[model samples]
Target: MAGYVVAAILLFSAVAYFVGRAAGERFVSANGDQVHSLPGYHGAFVAVWVGIPALILVLVWLSAQGSVIDGLVLGGLPADLVAGKTPSEINLLLSEIKNVAAGHIFSEPTPEIVAASQALLRWDEIARWAMVVVVLAMLIGTMFVARLRLAPRFRARTEVERVLSWLMIACAVSAILATLGIIVSLLAESFAFFRMVPLHEFLFGLRWEPQIAIRADQVAGQGAFGAVPVFVGTLVISCIAMAVAVPVGLYTAIYLVEYADERVRNIVKPLLEILAGVPTVVYGFFAVLTVAPAIRQAGSLMGLAISPNSALAAGLVMGVMIIPFISSLADDALRAVPRSMRDGSLAMGATRAETMLKVLLPAALPGIMGGILLALSRAIGETMIVVMAAGLIATLTINPIDSVTTVTVQIVTLLIGDTEFDSPKTLAAFALGLMLFLVTLALNVIALTIVRKYREQYE
Candidate 1:
């Protein structure tokens, strides 16, 4: 692996050198004007094409070669040595065989395994050398082809820029496709869940008590599939989070964009980002140690019995987590508003506050709404703070100060230990994941739609 990595790096470097030379090439045309673009772009274009495909081939070859070689070597081993083993045992035997070949397996070994190991090592080594030769040949051929194409009107620069754009689009497509793939996979699993527990029961049932008997003789309570209790908890916490984040974050953005001096914005913006940079686990601890206790004390003072792990605590910390999202988006949206609007408002004797409230904010409302959608998504999907701060009981309640669980926390609980793959407990996580995906997707779609409508109105 190390040798392959080193060889791949060298091949990439060589490709880069050649491609750079081709991209920015220039030659005086008949009218004495310089060529349209430099030759470096041409070089880059060839490099990207050559290196990309060959690198892909190398990776595929590397991944498949071991399994192909192993199958051949293992098949050649004596039947008695390989027979009667489970698939996992067969894998273990194969690993031992490899280790023996490499002189690392530390137990008494059968001659058949030793022989198989030797054969595998020999073939693996041969395969590596063959790959090295083929890849080098490919690199050389591509370089030769590129040099042949290096001429006055190669148009390499345009081709390279086009490739770069397509590459970025491919990256974005991958992200979207990955999200879609996850949703599909979860939907499949959740469909299985719905088959076991009816759709209406899972969606509207008010109690969530999941327990299944390990053995036929073992006694267990009927597993209730009602998700309403958790459904309500999730809603309450999310609303509290939004309530906290929106006012504070929007005000912060307004202050930074319309009120604060440049130096304060410079300092404050990074500080808010720093808050966003803090890991969720750290926030979880913050909720458990600081926020949860504070809420409990405050609840006590108010003559209320607030659980240590309550919705309010989780929601408040989540609001802190989401503040950066809204503030940053709001700031950008506010900045994008034309200066003329603020000037016009001011000329009419509107104060900064009045102008921001009446003109700038309304004009930037779509973008602000987009940011809130993003923040809402964050709140919905948050796991750590809620897991730590919200107690793990799914009850149908709307009180923010009561102990309750969210979907993420339940998913985490359902799958945290040694679990059977086919159990309903494990499948529940995927069902919850599907629901979360659909919800977040709906919010994002709405946000984009509103923003688009706002853009058209402005235009």
Candidate 2:
């Protein structure tokens, strides 16, 4: 019903725009040279009035209806059944009622639940009908007022521009508020985690266990939250990935830009970028099922031990996954170098290789470095490839052939199943997440600093 109302409102708004424009044109012709804005501006003014207010009201109604219905349904429940339950318990009961109301289950519901579901469905229908009526009335009334206000000398364009400026400001403010909300949430949960485990221990201690027994009598040992080992593993894998991606991707970009024929370059560049669109899970599978086993076999032949799941396997596959990102960005940066730079280098009697190495490459260094930093961030944040190819045993090691886990993997493992939300085990995920955010932020800052410094020099 709500969807139908929206569709009707849209259709009405479109009709209003054409009618409003015709009215403006007629008014302008009757009082020539008196009109200040174009006919199209009057049309847009009417369309905005017809759509924005109605849409805002519809959104407000939808947001409020759920809580209003929930309160009504829960308020009428039997006093005896609701007497001793906590808020969480009440919420769980409501979820079950909702599920039953939606016909998600085949089993019979209790009498109280059945009553509540019926009440909820009735209220939902009433709300939907009320919303439809209110929205349509608003669309009609606003459009009527806007059409009446359209005059020969009305400043329709100015009014329309003012509304658009406010909309832009609102969108900007919403994004800033969203970012602040995320930071506040992370800080609040991280503080709770730190109360259970000291900040210093989490930051500097070498071990990385995060399991905490839910009950005192549970057999599990108390978990350590040292994060250094996880950090080390992340660094090792990321370094290995960068080692494979940077030189290879950059060279590929150079070949496509400076050496390959136009036909060959066109064919090759898209194929290279196809790597970026391949899902990360596919890379994970390739790492686990294909790359890891091959590495193990090769290592065995060389009289070296390699884990079935190793950092090297994850890093190599991740590097392959990141190649497209680096190559595309580097190609753009390389292409941005002026053709005159190459021509001048050739005029100086420099060979093509020397010109590329000493002139074009240097000129494009900032962009190439930017691409590399971006790829490094990609490698650091990657989860699936590491989860499948690198085993989840956090060990403080630089050996790429050893099994290790990253911060993302640990955060995921800690929060996987049903667990106490406020417990340190769960809060630890927030702590790790905050650290990852900070690390990525630092990388971005560093990249910007380098780019700005070199950009100024080159310019």
Candidate 3:
């Protein structure tokens, strides 16, 4: 029904645009050179008026209809059915009522439930139809009013631009509010987790076991929330990945920018960027099935033991995955260097390598640093490859051949089942997330500082 309303509004909006455009054209013919806005602007103004308000109304109705219908149904039920019930119980009862309405009955429902379900369905249908009628009426009403306002003097372009500006503002505000909401949620949950487990233990302790036995009699290890190992593993793997990615990616960019001819650049750049398009899961598979085994075999040949699920395998694969980010950004940055700088250096009798090393690289350092930092963030937050290639042991070892876990892997492990939300185990995920957020934030701040410092020098 909502879809039908939206479709009708869109169809009518098109009609309104044409009608308003015709009206604007008529006004122009009647009073040539007096019309302030173009016919297209008039048409867009009419379309915005006809569609946006009605679309908003439909969205509001859809968001509110279910709750209103549920409340009405619950209110109409017998007092004994909901008398003194807690909010959770009431919610469960509402869920049952909805399930019955949807014909998902597990057993016979009581008469009150049956009657309430029927009322719920009836009210929902009525509300849906009412939404359709109201939206269509609004579309037509706005269409007529907008058409009536069309004249030689109406500033349709200004009105349309005003609406567009407001729309953009709303979108920006929504994004900011969403980010604030996420931070607040993470802070709240992390506080809950800290109440159950000490903050120092979570931040500084050396273990990462998050399992807590639900029953006192059950034999389970006392949960340890120390996150040192997870943090160390994340750092180690990211360092290894950066070690592989930065030099290779930077060199690739240099070759493409300075050495490759037009044909080679055109062919190689796209092929190199194809790495970014490959799914991470495919990389994970390559790590697990191919890279990990190869690493283990190579280790055996060297008379050293290597874990089958090793950090080295995950780090190598993740580095390959992020190569495109560094390569593409660095390529753009290197290419953005002023041609005058290169020509001046060459005119001073400097070799191409000397010119590139001394002039182009220093000039593009800020953008290259930005790309490396972005890739570092991507490496730090990666999960699938780590999970598939690096085992989830949370071992506090710097050895790339050792199996270790990262913060993202731990967060996934902590929240993987039908767990109680209020439990320390589940809340631990939020704590990890908060720490990860802070780490990434710190990285961004450091990157910005470096970029600003170099950008000033280069500019």
Candidate 4:
């Protein structure tokens, strides 16, 4: 029904646009050279007037309708089920009623539940019908007013541009608000986690066993919130990733920009970028099935012990995954260097290698640093490769061949299954997330400082 209403509104909006455009053309014809806005502008003005208000009406109705129906249905239920129940319990009851109403019954419904489901269905139908009627009326009335107001002097373009500018601002504000909301949520939950587990333990202590007993008398072990091992694992993997990605990606970019013929360059560049398009889960599978086994066998041949699920395998695959980021950014940066500089270096009798090493590289250092930093962040935040290739054990070792878990892996482990949000075990995920956020923020600040310092010199 809502879909039919939207389709109708769209159809009417299209009609209104043509009608308003015709009206504007008529006014221009009648008044000769007195017209201000174009016929298209007048059409757009009519479309905006018709569409915006109707969209708002539909949005408001859709947002409020579900809650209003839920309240009405729950209110009409037996007082005992609605009263003195926890939010989770009430939500579960609502879910069951919804399922039964949708004919997805898991079990026999009580008479009260049956009656409540019937009431819920009836209210939902009535609300949807009301929404359709109200939205259609809004579309028609606004469109009519807009048509009556259309004149050669209406300034439709200005009004349309103003509305569009506000929409852009609203979108920008929404993005900012969403980022702030995430930060605030993480902070609040981390604070709750810290109240249960000390800040120093989370940041400094070496152990990271996050299993907590559900009840005080339960035989399950106590939670240890120390995060040092997780942080170390994350650092080791990111370092390994950067070590592999930076030199290889940077060199690949150099070869493409300086040496390769156009045909080879074009072919190779896209083929390399195809790595970026490959899903991270596919990389994880490749790491687990192929890379990890190869590494283990190689280590055995070298008379060394290497874990089957090791940081080296995950980092190697992750590095391969992020190569395009570094290569693409570095290529752009290197290519951004003036051809004049290269010509001048050659005119000064410098070899290609000398010119590349002394001139182009230094000039593009800031951008290269930016690309490397991005790759590092990608490595740090990755979960799938680490989960598949790196073991769940939170070891403090920095050995790439050792099995270790990262902060992201630990967060996933902690949040799985039925979780009590208030428990330190679950809240620990937020605390880990907060620390990861801070680490990344610090990396960005440092990278910006370095990049800015060098960029000014180069510029």
TM-score of each: 0.82, 0.92, 0.95, 0.93
lDDT of 4 by residue, 236-271 (tens): 998888889988999999999999999999899999
On the 0 to 100 scale, the lDDT of residue 206 in model 2 is 87
Tens digits of per-residue lDDT, candidate 3, 300-382, equal: 99999999899999999999999998999999999999999999999999999999999999999988999999999999999
Off by over 4 Å in 2: 1-6, 24-35, 79-86, 103-110, 216-219
Reference-based TM-score, model 3? 0.95
At residue 386, give the lDDT of candidate 3. Answer: 99
- Residue-level error in angstroms, candidate 1, position 283: 1.2
Candidate 4 achieves a global lDDT of: 0.91
**In model 1, how large is the Cα lDDT of residue 402?**
86
Model 1 lDDT, full chain set? 0.84
Misplaced by over 4 Å in model 4 are 1-11, 27-33, 86-89, 102-109, 215-219
Tens digits of lDDT, candidate 2, 1-459? 878878988998898899789988997889888889889889989998898788788878888989998888889899987899999999988898899889876687898898888888898899998888788788889989999999989999999999899989989999999999999999999999999999999999988877778887877758899999999999999999999999899999999988999999989999998999999999999999999999999999999999998999999999999998789989999899999989999999999899999988888888998899899999999999999999889999999999999989988898899788999899999999999999999989998998898888778
- The lDDT for every candidate, in the order shown, is 0.84, 0.91, 0.93, 0.91
- Of 3 and 4, which scores higher on lDDT? 3
Q: Could you say which candidate leads in TM-score?
A: 3
**1 or 2, which is superior by TM-score?**
2
The C-alpha stretches of model 1 lying farther than 4 A from their native spots are: 2-7, 10-37, 66-130, 148-155, 158-176, 214-222
Distance from true location, Cα of 412 in model 2, Å: 2.2
